[model samples]
Target: MTILLVEDEDRLAAALIELFHAEKYLADHALRRAGKKTPVLMLTARDEIRDKIEGLDQGADDYMTKPFVPEELLARVRALSRRQGEVLLDELRFGDLCLSLATNELNAKGQSVRLAYKEAELLKLLIANKGVILSKETILRKLWGDESDAVENNVEAYVSFLRKKLGFLQSSVRIQAIRRQGYLLLEEEAL
Candidate 1:
């Protein structure tokens, strides 16, 4: 799972980022431009009712004030992750492959394989937009959000992993790279 820290304080941001990493979460600072699907836990020095309300109203999935306990912050982050996962419970199917969003498992040809969070998310995006080329920039922005640190190589890595999983499952679905365009999911003909 990933967490975006929007705290402007450098020292606080570093400490929180370290905590999240220690907890095995992919954590990063908030981007300049928002609109990320990833669950956000906004941390700020403002500790007023109106401030919290405004943060939530501005699209933060969760909000916390300064001088908070680490345990509570972790718990809130977990809750947000759970909530996001709940929305993806519906299974996605394309050709002979089935992706279970709840379990993050992919099944095909009598075999089932588990996927990491990012891998499952990337696969879902590709499958959802089947036959449509998704640009590297789009994938980065959607999956990794607008974090400037994320690069095209990150998208390529995940796509490579998904391709290996598909090959292992012997699925007809293929992720095709369209040179300068991007990637598109295609069902291959049986030989």
Candidate 2:
């Protein structure tokens, strides 16, 4: 799961403040890395308009000043989290296949089928990490989230579901179960 880096100005030491200043200069790099889906809520004591503008421009999903009400701070965080789950409509492509992260649709060979949310996420993960074996534990943590009750069987079931969908779409790409290891996404020709 993604985490929020809650940097409070009052808690920072002099050197740390300087480091944060450097981070402002590097905001461009940080923006690209965080992308649109990652929720960034910046907490700072600096209430200047420019500082707020800079933080927002730097890709913070939301910004709040110091001395914020404890309840309101929590509300904003929850709001941001809910917003993150909203449809961004981003697409991840690999080989002949395309998976829509927002709508959970998988497409290939001019054919498409809707997938469950978990299935789409799993496909995206495999596509992004093609050729790398993803252990069951990693899958559980990523797809089911940290400290999830999901087990290896849950991963296997979703892999099975995705493989069937790939076949249905007539996609050249496929997911292979690596026994005693994990899973791999590959074209049939790569076998």
Candidate 3:
């Protein structure tokens, strides 16, 4: 969690650095050449949209303006960290296989597979709702944000997509469809 405090104010920057350090954050000042890895956060007094965009475009995971509440900034930073970690976890395992949330990469008994965007989203939703029978309406609402506009059949299509991807990935977990009810993300052992 390296934070790039780009504020021109010496005293304020120093205080923020100290505060982040106290929170066990490995924060640093100044920007460096971007490469793979390390979350960056930019803090500046510049409230302009251009400044915010520039900061993010420069590889900062999050950007904050000055005179902001420190707690709010901390919350944002923590959320970003959690999201990143969730994506990278090696295996969302049910039995013998695991789903890579980071890359949508899958590994099962030595086999590896990639998931499409919609497939991954649907799989994630199912996993999040593991053990719960997710109704078609509920799944549609979650995916398309509007149940009325998007047909319920889209959920069925996506579930099929996920099942195919998971099969290719050799995952033990299965998406079980209950007639007239909905779908459930069932672990191998549970089934």
Candidate 4:
């Protein structure tokens, strides 16, 4: 996750950046202005509510003031991250294969292949977190909606199915096991 921290206070910004990093968030500082398309969390000591509102108007996901608790900031960032995950939709591509979330279609080399609901969800999560190791619990919660009755092996089954579909697509996107850790999406070249 990419987070933009817009704080003019040098010491506080550095401390918060460290805190965010400790929480496993990739935080970037915005000294002058926001960058292209990155999610932002603006911080300001400006008492006027307009300053906060203006930051949000400028595309910040959330805004905070000074004397704020670290826990509160972390919570807000987590909420924004969850919101982004929930609304994830776009034309996702990996290698030569492309999947259109809007159209619910998978295409490769100008040909289409059918994918089941679970298979598509699994593929989307893997593609979204590509190059990052996703734990088993994380994958299960994402695909199975945090239901306890959902067996852990369900992820394995869907992954297997996705592998077959990728084969049909003639693509090399594969779910690779990391022994005790979980899995990583490996491209044909990476594999």
Q: Candidate 2 lDDT, tens digit per residue, 1-191?
A: 13244464322322232332222211111232544565676778899999999998887879888766756855765576577674322576788988765577888999999998678767766865689998988777656645457788999899999889999999999888789999988988777
Q: Candidate 2: misplaced stretches above 4 Å?
A: 1-89
Per-residue lDDT over 1-191 for candidate 1, one digit per residue giving the tens place of the 0 to 100 score: 65667887755776786677456455666642465687788988899999999998888888898889999998998798789884423477888998875788899999999999889878867875677899998788657655458899999999999999999999988899999999998889722
C-alpha TM-scores of all predictions: 0.54, 0.55, 0.53, 0.56
Worst window of 10 by summed lDDT in candidate 4: 25-34
Which is the better candidate, 1 or 4, if ranked by TM-score? 4
Q: Which residue pairs come into collision in candidate 1? A: none
Q: Model 4, stretches more than 4 Å misplaced?
A: 1-37, 40-60, 63-90
Candidate 3, residues 1-191, lDDT tens digits: the string is: 44455555655665675676455444444565656466677777788999888878878788887678989978976777786673433445556656665677767778988887567667766765578898998776555544147788888888888888678866778899999899988867787
Each candidate: what lDDT?
Answer: 0.80, 0.68, 0.69, 0.73
For candidate 3, what's the RMSD?
Answer: 14.1
lDDT of 3 at 50: 93
Ranked by TM-score, the better of candidates 1 and 3 is 1
lDDT of 2: 0.68
